[model samples]
Target: MDKQELGAFLRTRRERLRPEDVGLVSGARRRTPGLRREEIAVLAHISTEYYVRLEQGRAPRPSGDVLAGISAALLLTDAESEHLHLLAGTAPIQTGLHRRDVRPSILTLLERLTQTAGFVTSATFEVLAWNDLAAALMEDFGALAPADRNLARKVFLVSDGDGRGGPLYGISDRAEFRQTVVMRLRTTMARYPSDPAVIGLVEELRSGSAEFARLWERHDVQSVPMLTKTFRHPVVGDVTVDCDSLALTDRDQHLVLYSAPQGSRDAEALALLSVLGTEGIDMVPDARR
Candidate 1:
């Protein structure tokens, strides 16, 4: 990543905020436009020299606590705080447990959501496990390769020839949507920098798509829980689905649910999903061809 640019951008953002923005009062005769380095250091409970070192890119690693302190002192946005942690190279701290081995109860919980399309995803956006409805709603989910089953990767790589992969639920503004996904992936990467899987996926995307690279450099972070999306299904035709993402508090896993909009034709299409399930049909293919 662009460490120098990150350092400079953070310093610039920190210097652009006024004391009043963070509920601090500034006395008269201050020469600078923003909080002074010493003042910020005091607020963050760090030495001026250390904070200076951080701004100068001399500090190799800063703890999450320190980064949080500085984030608060600077009144940073969520995206900015996440970016700060990434620049500090201390993000995505593991909790000393294998995320892949989360409680079996979660799997049971997913099975209970029969009417809705649901699945549990890892922090790196891998679809670790999914339910029947999820598989039927999105044909691509059924077609994901074992190694390339990632949301960000699918969004960028799964496309029709000539660079148009069709629309994500007939959404005309796909470029913005793609960028949003990239930003979220970048944020996740920042938090889990040591995850080789996550790193490798990013490197692959960078090499494959210039658009992804440009958006990654912007460093945007967002947590969108609920959205309405349309999908053009080969069998059912066009369907509008309401997608929701819920965080599993017990683990670093997220449960994603997809539902059809009430009173819409898609809702009728979803009803067919249960019939498919009852027939013992495995909608997801054993492999992507």
Candidate 2:
């Protein structure tokens, strides 16, 4: 069990709750945020001391019943409740390196996805494979070294050089995407805590980016779904597309497809990108180099 992380997660969730959120009265002006430990203990039907110990990281592995109580007390969502189980070692963990290999059929599907920008991302958000349209819509991932293909790295580490933030493909959902990256990485960390790459990547992001560090400390494990996004492509000006991410369950990866409705201007832009390829694109904006 990841005792420290579990404690941290519990603490964050508890602090996000208001007294009235769980039907408790706001008796007085509060000194700290969220419901108090005693209040949570009362709500969860556990001893205040034990809940405190759990938050202090001094408690033993909580039983399933105890965890359920705590989950209810904190009003965790389904994803957050599952994360609580993972952190407490009650759920099955991957316990190995995250898979990076893209299934051959997925690769073929990417190629067959005509006029659509398609790419597969590993558990850690590494771009494992992409079609020509993906390269055109984004940058040419095929030209980047394996280590440079990680989207989390690109999101947090690689800056746009104008003090804005990381290279976000000039996408309009930069903030949302960053949160999604952090939330998914938190899940990945719980699943593959022993994986060197995951460990190293988390360490690198925490140290390199203050934004990442702040988000990491929030202990969030759920991401709001991004339905549509607009990309300010250097060549195409703006191309808005519907975002569809299909989970490759066997490989623990995501096939992310960006497509615009047929007969739309965005669709025409995608078509143009398909033919242009990455001929005029540079992976990093020239100013960054």
- The best candidate by lDDT is 2
Residues 173-224 of candidate 2: C-alpha lDDT, one tens digit per residue: 9889999999999999999999999999999999999999999999999899
TM-score of each: 0.70, 0.96
Runs in model 1 deviating more than 4 A are 1-56, 60-74, 82-92, 95-98, 140-144, 162-173, 223-226, 261-263, 277-289
**CA error at residue 119 for candidate 1, angstroms:** 1.7
Writing each residue's lDDT as its tens digit, candidate 1 over 1-289 gives 4366456656676678787877888789888777788888888999999888777777667777888898888778786776776666566455233265546887787788777778877766677888777776654454557566666676676664658433443443466668767866666666556677777888988888877887776545654443776665545656677878887755677788878766777778887865665232343343222
Per-prediction count of colliding residue pairs?
6, 0
**Which candidate tops TM-score?**
2
Q: How high is the lDDT of residue 288 in model 1?
A: 24
Model 2 regions lying over 4 Å from their true place = 280-289
